[model samples]
Target: MKRHPRRSVPATLTALVLLAACALVAVVTIQMLLGETPWIRYDTVAAALHGTRWTDTVTAIVGAAAVLLGLILVLAAIIPGKPVVLPLRGDLDSGASRRSYRSTLRVAASAVDGVSDARVKLKPRTIAATVTTGRTTIDGLADAVRRSVEERLDQIDPAVRPTVRVKIRAVRKAS
Candidate 1:
């Protein structure tokens, strides 16, 4: 089967990291099971495990289980990086998070009489609107965009104050 060349390095590193993590976990688990301090181990751990075959067997089984679990997790991440890597917008900490919100604002602003093109940016506390209105001075166009956005936002959250910036990129007569 054809494989993704880019997947190799990350997959190998993930496997290595998983192996090391499993080893560390096994060491810590064995230490804890033998009544040693979590961070610093006591000499009693070796003595107790050496004397008790049952404890030694349990430690071996648990260590193997942890190693197998870690390997499985590493393989899972390596096989499909999509689940491990979150989408860009998924990390957003904002109210207007949906892509449709920005696109809608742009389309809605451009639908106005003088607007030629528009871009909308939304953040947690503020919304910024930039419009290219077909006029020499964008003051009137900016006002229109602000009003439109404010009305829309008021329906959602009346308290939100938007900053609308209109730049007259180009002017053309209506056909």
Candidate 2:
């Protein structure tokens, strides 16, 4: 089954900060109800809020921070999540990782005659391969690699059929 890639860092940080703030408020409230010394005095808070310069500076900083945080949250909600796996033939959960697809394509391309090495890049809608060939004739090498890679892709039958692009590079002969 295709799973959405996780946005862990922001989510984790937000959760931790919220939990810490809640714990602090809870502790302070409990101390106040018990008539114990609070971590922060009410007078200090009143003074800070009543002061013109400090209050204005704090308000501006908080406003800017809130705006930035809102933008981040909006962006996180709007951006499309990337797929964790590419669906393949068979059971509903059957699929392949992108790395597996690239490896399969690279092996397939490298199997072509005269191909010394192969590098493959798999995208959502395209499969690109670069092959290094030996002294063999350059004619039809790219086509052969493309055909081989396409055949492999067809066998896998991924959710999206990617167009194949082959690039051939010849190895330099030793002097």
Candidate 3:
């Protein structure tokens, strides 16, 4: 299953633009029907269109901007977003959200000895962990944390096993 987040921004902006355009037309139609002048007259717009030349810098700039905006909107609508939930192995019959998965790995790293704190960053195929210890000398803390994280990852049994990388940071001693 391909599960990814839907981009709401483009849809929202498009809806708002359509709504405004429709409202503007309705307002103008009502004014014209009432035998009064509209805020923006269609004849004025026609005159402006007739007066402007394609070679004019202002017209060229406006055309370029419109084209760029259209391309951006099309790309935004077509591009796939990052997956929010990663599927687990078949036997598990479940999925883990990015947040929950990262937290589980962080808990494993923090459970190790001399690990005061753990910060986990999840990428597509790598789980990078930074563990902070109170001790100034961290000889094998990074390896221990990596092993802890990897063991927990195995237990989770995700569909794709990301490599574990652990970085150890020690709290500075008081002067």
Candidate 4:
């Protein structure tokens, strides 16, 4: 019953940056071959490759740096760690909150006989939710969801009392 941890933003961003760098390098290489602007002077560079020139050395260093930077990015994404979880601020937590009570609540709701989607929102004094069940009545499915949620919460806090409201957002048409 292990829930998948969310992806890390930094890691994801690093991965995207790496991909962009690789793409940029590929595009630049293609442009160099095609005699495009900015990359229009490969012949001179190739000639420089034959000589012991400072420009050739600088170009080699820059290329190496770019490759090393890209490698570092790919490594960052592959490192093992839990996804970053930013805590809700005190102000936000005290207000009408919608934190998932537990994974079971979502799993249970999703498992309901006719529910296509079940999203539960917990507020100060009530639990407002929406369920998408093609063949299920909204009221009946909502009540079921509420009961399931309450039952799950009761295990932790027996005195937990919250009004439950269920709304049907959409029903998929059968083909």
Candidate 5:
């Protein structure tokens, strides 16, 4: 089971940059077609670049910036984002996503007596649960959550088993 995070952010950024460049080119071409003076003075710019030396500070800085931008874009495209699913141990190799696993752990934590709500954070090495309850005294609540979560983990048997850590919080109902 393999899963990767969405690349919307990088894709959107690249699209915006390309859109700006394409718009500039289109506007310049249209102005030239209409025989109007374009905002960009191509002759002056060409002459400036033609006279600029590779060792010149301005030319060197521009080159460095362009290379840096190109490198960043390349890396973003090539790098794989974090997986959406946590791989499991057993056979079948069906992609069991972390969301479903977290939800399962949440159900276990909430099943414990006195637990009003449960929030779970799952990492490769640790599974943390924050439990909210109406009971003023939270004695044994954390242990119960840990036991419940562990039981759920035993059932799921993920490839990387995370230790269960539970925190209990008390809340009073306001009328």
Candidate 6:
């Protein structure tokens, strides 16, 4: 089963609020059972409910907040989440994350001679590589990097073979 990422913030807050409310109710019930003064007086609550008149501004604010909260919950439930990792052919049981792919591409590109450093970005449909070369200018370095990255990607066998784009830059010497 594919595991979905959780939106924990709202869920946790809601749980805490519910727990507190339940605890308060439990405390009130226990007090009434034991014949002790209640933490919340029922008479005060009844009076407040029966006699209090809500102002127009307060009612409007409360209604807007409720509507906004409902809309947020609905939208969160409706939207589909993007997976952090792309599934590989070999690892059906376990998947490789995009970060891992990026690192692999960087290493592959850096393996090429004349490439001092490599930076790789893996997108849904594109693999971008930037390589820095030493003082010597290597002809076709960009093409070589692109080919190397493409080859590495072929080994992974991603769902979609992204187009490889390579950019080569000469390393700047310190003055």
Give the range of the ten consecutive residues with the poorest summed lDDT in model 1.
81-90
lDDT of 2 by residue, 1-175 (tens): 7766777877888899999999988998899999999998778888977775644877889889999998997788668576767788666668887677789889999999999999998767888899998854688989999999889988999876889999988886535
As a whole number from 0 to 100, the lDDT of residue 66 in candidate 2 is 94
TM-score rank order: 3, 2, 5, 6, 1, 4
Q: How well does model 6 score by local distance difference test?
A: 0.79
Please give the TM-score that candidate 4 achieves against the real structure: 0.37
lDDT value, residue 75 of candidate 4: 64
| Sequence-dependent TM-score of model 5 | 0.74
Task: List per-candidate RMSD values in Å.
Answer: 15.8, 3.2, 2.1, 13.0, 4.1, 3.7
Best by TM-score: 3
Candidate 3 ranges beyond 4 A from true positions: 91-93, 173-175
lDDT, residue 127, candidate 1: 64
- Cα lDDT tens digits for candidate 5, 31-71: 98899998787898899889999889998899999999889
Q: Write the per-residue lDDT of candidate 3 for residues 1-175, one digit (tens) a residue.
A: 4378887888899899999999999999999999899999999999999999989999999999999989999999888777788889886467888889889999999999999999999888899899999987788888899889989988988998899888888896635
Question: Per-residue lDDT tens digits of candidate 1, residues 109-144?
Answer: 777787877888765455677777557555577677
* Reference-based lDDT, each prediction: 0.62, 0.84, 0.89, 0.61, 0.86, 0.79
Worst 10 residues of 3 by lDDT: 166-175
Clashes of each: 0, 0, 0, 0, 0, 0
- Residue 151 error, candidate 6, Å: 0.7
Which ten residues in a row are the worst by lDDT in model 2?
Answer: 48-57
| lDDT score for residue 1 of model 6 | 23
TM-score, one value per model: 0.40, 0.78, 0.91, 0.37, 0.74, 0.71
Root-mean-square deviation of Cα positions for candidate 6 versus the true structure, in angstroms = 3.7
Cα misplacement distance, residue 12 of candidate 5 (Å): 2.2
Model 1 compared with the native: what TM-score?
0.40
The positional error of residue 161 in candidate 5, measured at the CA in angstroms, is 1.5
lDDT of 3 at 44: 96
